[model samples]
Target: MTPISSLANPTIKHAAALLTQHRIRKKSGQTVLEGVHLIEAAIKQNFTIKQIIIGQSALSHPEVAGLIEQIAQSIILATDAVYKQIRSLGTGVDIMAIVEIPTPALGVITSDCLILDGLQDLGNIGTLLRTASAVGISTIISTTGTAHLWSPKCLRAGMGAHFSLAIFEQVDYEAILQKVKIPLYATSSHTDKVIYQHNLTQPIAWVLGHEGQGVSEIFLRTATAIALPQPNGQESLNVGVAGSVCFYEMLRQRQFAQH
Candidate 1:
């Protein structure tokens, strides 16, 4: 029942800065989740919740109602107008939470892996992680060049995927080298080895590279490059789509061989 109406409120200003500026989030060691789905996902994933800012209007929603009754975290009550003032920049999301995500380590997360070399699009990277987890790829290690997995855009695009798996962001190739012992494969348009030609039954790291630059020389130095057969003139598979194909293919092989 606490009405926070002042933009000058320290917590409100901090949240506004977090939503508007990336540096502010990193500086403060926190992130903002605007939609109820995203906030609940963070909660399910056990991310540290520092502030739960709810719109007075949102109290009627079932998700918000459930969260208020079950969660012991701090809560901030704001008028609907005040809530909208700090809502995410163009998203129309009415609820928001500030949660702390762990700074990721630079190594192999699990046996089946998805290694992102330099993907920049937060949405693409996030969806890939979501798809990866769905196919039972348990761990993902992203190079420093990719979008931050904990960023709001990536988190939303992930659609709660992080709740079920280990994600390491801001990692380096040297770290990957030490962690992944099984074969590492990279996705490309010009590879000589088609996906079916390779045996994916073995544990492998499917490395999808930069958006336009493709995989790196450093990764290429060690990875066996892989490509989807394109009989038509399709230029390249979108990285997220490409990774999805690779993950399911790996699943198909593993599941079939297991039987």
Candidate 2:
């Protein structure tokens, strides 16, 4: 078992490229999943694992050792110096993996879904995806202007939601509109009809817009205008928070109806 101690190693450099350059990741059809939790999630989902790199410090952990032995992929030990260079963003990440990004066809979406319209902030996009996954919305569609759905920053923020979700990116909402038969609700700061007033149990699509521009007019034309009550007079809420509130409300409504 050769340890990857050299900074110039192609594997290390390639992982670095995936983190810094979105085009490289997309072109190669590979993305880096950092941390033990994310790596485990990807494995649990049975996503294709190309390689697993474990830091020297990470090897002592029982779970890390178990994964290295159980996973039938190329496993390399990384020295602290090398690990620091390729480790995923954030604290306590002593393990990382290079996994093939699954390119599943756009098949029928059966569950309630979320539409991200022109969202640019990676953190917001990730948070919304995480929220959507937590609340049982399995399909998420992102329009052209949105952040790269699989970018490392977004992936980190999403935690493991990406594994559970059927995320379609660079989509045209109008084309989606033609295929989806459910009601599409667009969030509006100006709308009088608050979200609480509506029955959200039925399968529907909630369109969350960009931080600044809001939802595009074209999408709005086909969507029901809905607002969240902002009694504190704050003119607006962060797109992530707004989307989460709507998702939870939908859950609450459906759960109550079930009882």
Candidate 3:
């Protein structure tokens, strides 16, 4: 296909604006995926690819033959200048797509699970996901104030981990409580129960707190609060790191009992 001649092409202009504004994305009910890695991730997660825009120069420089072939959209070609102008990153990827956001499933947990309350760092959210996938946790329920799992940065930082598990985000505080019936162990700085002493073989949901503040008091009023001991001078750990630590301890204990 020859390079696009019209900078005013209705599709191109719309996509350009859509990339810059969150309102347009929400109104349109679409999320943009940049680069081959993210495009591939979205596909694996079964997100609908509404459209794809590829730069003329990128055609041969870094061929995403696989992604292009898999795309179900009418691939719109753009001039290198036009591509550069629309991309959010300085060194833009060869392609970008406006994808339909996958609505979070109402997951029913039959095994160990992780729950988050208002944890908002994209990097932290991603790290928690990667760790969750590694530690035999296949389900996560993210409640009020947590970073959106579908957001671009979280997806990228996750490195495709979203495609690996059933993650429910944007859940309400009360909704999460009603959904999880297993013994919920909420993380807190103040707890008499050391994590090691807790029984891990039982079905559980590890409720994690957000940055700056710990678990919400309402949840603590009902759920058991637990803490992991930190020997170093550091008083606190990143929620993602702390959550990962807690998860693996359960994994370790389970593994030990098996041996």
Candidate 4:
């Protein structure tokens, strides 16, 4: 295909708009993946890549070339000027792919999962996702107040974890509480019960709260409270760190049981 150099090109404009506008993404159920690694990860996970765009400068990169050969859709070559608008500066991003966001078939709400409750920081959301996947938590649910699960910032910070796991975003907190099969555990700075004392082996749904407000009172009222002991006198841990600690503890407990 001829190299697309015009900013007015329809495909080019659509891709740029998708990167910046949440409404467009939500309406179309699509998202952008920047860089070769994410594209490769999506392909490995069998995500439907609608199209792949490669900068003229990166056309010869083996990674880009390999992606072109593997993807069975449009692979557009673009001038650096046009490509520059598509990738964030300093990311060394020479390729980007437009992909359809898969609707998670939440067949059953299983325990041993993490539910993000009103978490606002996109980076923290992404980090929690990566941590959840690391601990073998396959299903994640993000309530209405949480950041967009497929937002570019979250997608980038997730480092390909998004494609490997099942995520249900914009979920109703109350709806889940009504239907969840296992205990819902929420962390608190003031709780008397420490996480270590909790039975981690039993399938449980971990409810991570907002960074500033902690979990919503709705969750606090319905969920069991677990505390993280901070000997350093820190007022609180970052939500991402606190959530990871809980996940690792759960992993440790489950591993010990297998032994």
- The candidate that wins on lDDT is 4
> What does candidate 3's lDDT look like per residue over 1-259, in tens digits?
8777676888777777676665676577676677888788778878778888888877764447778877777788898887887777567566888777656667456677888788878789888888988887888888867767766667677777777788787788777777777888887877768788888778888888778887888778887777778778578888888888888888888886554
The window of 10 residues in a row where model 2 has the poorest summed lDDT is 102-111
- Clashing pairs for model 3 are none
Would you list the C-alpha lDDT of every candidate in the order shown? Answer: 0.81, 0.85, 0.78, 0.86
Those runs of model 1 whose alpha carbons end farther than 4 Å from true positions after fitting are 89-93, 107-110, 256-259
lDDT of 2 by residue, 1-259 (tens): 6678997888888888888898898899898988878888888888888988888877888888878876998888889778987666655858888988766655556568898988999999999999999988988888887888888788889998999988887877666776666888889976799999998888988899989989989888988889999888998999999999999999899886545
Q: Would you estimate the TM-scores of all the predictions?
A: 0.92, 0.94, 0.87, 0.95
Model 2 regions lying over 4 Å from their true place: 88-91, 108-110, 257-259
Candidate 4, poorest ten consecutive residues by summed lDDT = 104-113
For candidate 4, lDDT tens digit of each residue in 1-259?
Answer: 5789898988888889889999999998998988988889899999999988888989988878888889889888899888997676354848999999878645557667788998999999999989998888888888887889898788989999999888888878667776677888999876888988988888889999889998988888878899999888898999999999999988889896555
- Each prediction's RMSD to truth: 2.0, 1.7, 2.5, 1.6
Worst 10 residues of 3 by lDDT: 101-110
The all-Cα superposition gives candidate 2 an RMSD in Å to the true structure of 1.7
Give the C-alpha lDDT of model 3.
0.78
Of 1 and 3, the candidate ranking higher by TM-score: 1
lDDT of 1 at 200: 90
